[model samples]
Target: MEISTCTEKMVQIIANSTLEKSLKKTLKEVGVSGYTLFDVRGDGDSGDQSGHLEGDSNILMMVVVPLKTSQNLMEALNGYLKKGHHLMVFSVDAEVLTPSKFG
Candidate 1:
C-alpha cells in the first residue's frame, strides 16, 4: 500500500466534560467534520479524571483533519486552557484510505 500525502492528522483531545461544548464549537469552526468521542477515565496533572460519573468525568475526542485546521484549533484552544480548563491536544499523522471521504 502506498501512503498518500494528505497532510491530515488525527487530533486527540482529552479534557473535562465541562469543556465539551467549547471543544465542539471550536472543532466546527476549524472545519473538522467527523470525530469519535468516548467517555474516558484517567488521571492527570490536575487529578483523577475517571469518566465514571456524570459530573466527575472526562471526554476523549479524536478527529481527523487537515493540518491547517488542526493548527487553527490549537490556536483557539489557548484561551480555554488559560481559563484553567483541563485540556490536552495532540496531532499525529492520519493514513488516508479513502481520500474522497475527506474532501
Candidate 2:
C-alpha cells in the first residue's frame, strides 16, 4: 500500500438560491467536473434569510478540482459577482482520498 499527498483546489460558493440554475451553468462553462450544492442559512450584509423559505435562503456549492480549473471558475464568478449578485467564493487546498475521481 502507498499513499501520497496530492495538490487539490476546492472552491466554496455561497450565494442566493435564485442563482441556482445560473450558477450550475457557470460551473459547467467553467469546466468543473464535480460539485455539491446544499441549502444553508447565515447572516451577512444582506440581512438574514433564515425565516423565509426557498429563494429567501441561500445555497452552498463546493467544487473540487485542479488549480487551473479553479482559477477559471473564480474568474467567471468575479465578473458575475460585480453584477450585484449575493455570491461569496473562497478556495482552499484539499486532500483528495481518491485522486482519480477528480481527474
- Residues 1-103, candidate 1: write the lDDT tens digits: 8666554778899888887887888888877887899888877787787666676898889988777777887888877888877688888988766562446
Q: Which candidate wins on TM-score? A: 2
Best model number under lDDT: 2
lDDT of candidates 1 onward, in order: 0.79, 0.86
Over the full model, what C-alpha lDDT does candidate 2 score relative to the true structure? 0.86
Q: Which regions of candidate 2 are displaced past 4 Å?
A: 100-103
- TM per candidate comes to 0.83, 0.89
